[model samples]
Target: MKSVAHVYPWDIIGDPGAVQRILDLGVDAVALAASYHTVRAATPLHPEHRLVDARHAALYVPVREQAWGGRRLTPAEPSWVDGPDSYGQARDALKAAGLPVYAWTVLTHSSRLGDLAPEVVVRNAFGDRYPYALCTAQPEVVEYALTLVREIVEQGQPDGVVLEACGPLGFFHGGHHEKTEGGDWGKVRQALLSICFCTACAARCTEAGIEVDTLRAQVRNAVDAGEPDSVESALGAELASALAAVRTSVVAQLRALLVGEVRELAPQARVIVHASADPWATGPFATAAPELGVEVDAVVAMCWPGPEASIPGIEALRKLAPGTRIAGYVLALPPKPIEAAAMRAELAALAAAGVQEFHLYHAGLASGARLAVVREALDSLGQRP
Candidate 1:
């Protein structure tokens, strides 16, 4: 089994000991953020500064005018981190230390871009715009995602690429100080609310033989009634299935375009996606429906929900893409105790459930103690690659 640790450019840029600390973790590679959304990250072990407030979504690489010329949805350069090419600088240092690097590219999750172009963002069933989610149903958003990937592969020259939010984002916006929990919405209601009714999406659904207004009304009525336990129940079987087909189709098209771009740019680079087997899933881990035939080197399932939730997801993904490796996106941060035994058990459980890779989350933000626990857990699992 292989192990890859997630990190940021700021984690490596000014910290002399960053490379050595990462090496000590026994990871085979590092998934460094190439393009990322807003975050006030904590550099627990950096020598220069402790906190980095990335005020907006920005590309870590230098934003070339030629690459983004005439494009309205171009990526912004990071002002929080010093230097024009933080990704390049960090990539060079990690490569020098003999650690393979994967460009962790985030797509369709930029609030800054969405705010600038409201029409391109996701509009819910009630026509409420999610300013944080760039609706992939829009042609401009698709073009932006492709351009971003092209830049990362052509410039960053990574050994691999890990794609996040490769499809349309829905109601979830983590960093926006969300206040929706007050409504007491269940998982079913949340999924319903996630249904996009934007111009492009509605058109797509209509083309797929769905009544746009009727479906929207049904969605609203479902929310009001608050009776249905699942999306299928709320929208009725036929409508629900049709809606899923449309959603999955959108995700499938975007994934293919991005993956094709990556393959064309660098055939040797491994392609990994943060994904879910569930057809209705959205957000960072987009749906990797088996029927669509996910074409990637690996599928990384979010394992922060623990073994019970994560194991089944991994199993489902394994069945979906049997040829591709399954990676557990394991979390070692807060809410998860900094203990080797506990962490090792989770890793072991995932491995047993057919997870061929372990993708450790946030090596940059983790404290020395937390990192130590990660190292110990990997050591225990014999996962040092």
Candidate 2:
């Protein structure tokens, strides 16, 4: 099976030894995060030892012009101590080390732009704008995403590009010292609140023969009453089916847009997408997989498992898109055991499930021991043909 590792550009710039250390891990390819959203504290080893505040950061690499395809795409704030073109530098260094690099691009999930243009943000049934999640139904958001992909393909010169959060991001966000309380909220409730009711999205639904106002009111009532499961039954099968299809279709169209843009702009670069096992509420895997076969080279399922974690989604996806490659994205750090044996078992199970490739979630944030676990797992998994 193919062995790949995900990494942040800061890790390479921050730590002088990062490249060698990664080479030591024995991965077949490296997935470098090209365009990422905001984060509080990140340590890039360039200046050595000091923690850098990378809040609402943009391209880790120095962009030649702040604009992509004549549109002004935001860059990471000046707080980044490294040079603006850090991405190119990092890719060059890794390439010199003989490791292939893929651009791990994140399309949405940006609070910085959302905060600046609240009008483009995703609004729920209650009309509360999620200041972090940008709605793709908005034309400008799609344009920016296209520009970002075009720039990465034309400039970065990566072996491939891995797209993550390529569609709308849900309410779940990682803020520093996050806190929450009250009822569990559950999957159904979260899904209800995650639906975007922005004018653009509503317009698309209307075009699909869906009554946006009625659907929105029903959703609002379901969420308010804490009766998410009852939502479908209340709406009746016909309306429910229409609403579900519309919601899923919105995300699929956005994914198709980006995939098409990349293929047209950078035909040589391989296109792999981060597809979640459960593609609902805020993701696009389930509904988009069939159409994606025409564009995507492979689907990397986010199956970060624990000791007893089961990956039924792998089989489910295989059935949905029979001939497409189904890769597994494993978490190398906490929430997952750091033991090499546990990690190996997880890899073994994924391989058994007919997963032809494995992409380790992250290499930068992982501790030395955790990384060692990853290395051990790769070593045990043997080589990919």
Candidate 3:
């Protein structure tokens, strides 16, 4: 099995010992952020500033005018980092230290772009807009994602690429000072709320033989009537199936186009997608049902929910996409105890469930004690092949 550590560009740009620290952790590669969304990240061990407030989604590399070509949804360059090419500088430094780097590209989860162009963001059933969730059903959003991928691959020049949020984001915006928990919206209601009703999505659903107005009404009624057991239960099987088909197709097309662009530009680079087997899942780990039929080198499942929940998901994905590598996106930070034995146990359980790779989350944010636990756990797992 292979292990990859996740880090932000800010973690490496000014910190001289950052690469060495990562090397000591015994990870095979680093998934360095090429484009990222808003966050106030904690650099617990950096020699420079300890906190980095990346106020918005921005590209770590230079936002070349020629590359964007006057697109209204162009990415902004991060002001927190010192250099014009933070990604490039970090990539070169990590490479110099003999660690392979993968350009970790975030696709459609940009609040900055969504705020600038509300027409491209997801609008839920009740006509409420989710500024953080970019609806991939729009042509402009698709074009923007393709351009982002092209710039990352062409500029960063990494050994591989890891694509995140490769499809439409849904209602869950974690960092928006969320305050909807009092509504007691269960899983079913949350899923219903995630259903996009934007013009493009409506047109696509119409093309799929779904009545948009009636479907939207049913969605609203379902939410109002309290949570059902599942999405299919709330919206009848026929309607749910149609909606799922349309949403899956939207994600598949966007994924295909982006992957195709990567292939054409850098055929040698390996492509790994953050994906889920569930047809209704959205956000960063988008739905990558077998029916979508796009090929990628690896698929990573979010494993932060622990082994009981995550192992089964990993198994489902394995059966769905046979012959492709399956990775567990394991968390190494808070809420998880700073203990190597516990971490190693979870990693072993995932591996037993057929996980061929491990993607450790937030190397840049974890404290030294937590990182030591990560290093020890990885050491217990033995060397990567």
TM-score of each: 0.98, 0.90, 0.98
Please report the TM-score between candidate 2 and the true structure.
0.90
Q: Which stretches of candidate 1 lie over 4 Å from their true place?
A: 292-294
- lDDT of every predicted structure (CA atoms): 0.90, 0.74, 0.90
lDDT of model 2, residue 176 = 48
- Candidate 3 at residue 317, lDDT? 87
Cα lDDT, model 3, residue 52: 93
The sequence of per-residue lDDT tens digits that candidate 1 reaches over residues 129-155 is 888899889998998999999999999
| Runs with alpha carbons beyond 4 Å of true place in candidate 2 | 41-47, 64-73, 174-177, 277-279, 283-293, 307-310
> Which runs of model 3 end up more than 4 angstroms from their true locations?
none
Query: How does candidate 3 score on lDDT?
Result: 0.90
Candidate 2 structure quality by residue, lDDT tens digits, 1-385: 6888887777787577899878988888899878887654434333475455567748755565556435543645345646666778878889998999999888877878887788888888888888778888788888878777877888888899888877787656534465633646666777777778888888888998988889888887777676555446646678877776776666677778888877887788788986653545464233353345455778877676542454676776676566889888778867877788988888888888888888887787777788889888888888532
Q: How many clashes show up in model 2?
A: 11
Go through the candidates in order and give the C-alpha RMSD of each one to the true structure: 1.0, 2.7, 1.1
> Residue 361 in model 1: shift from native, Å?
0.7
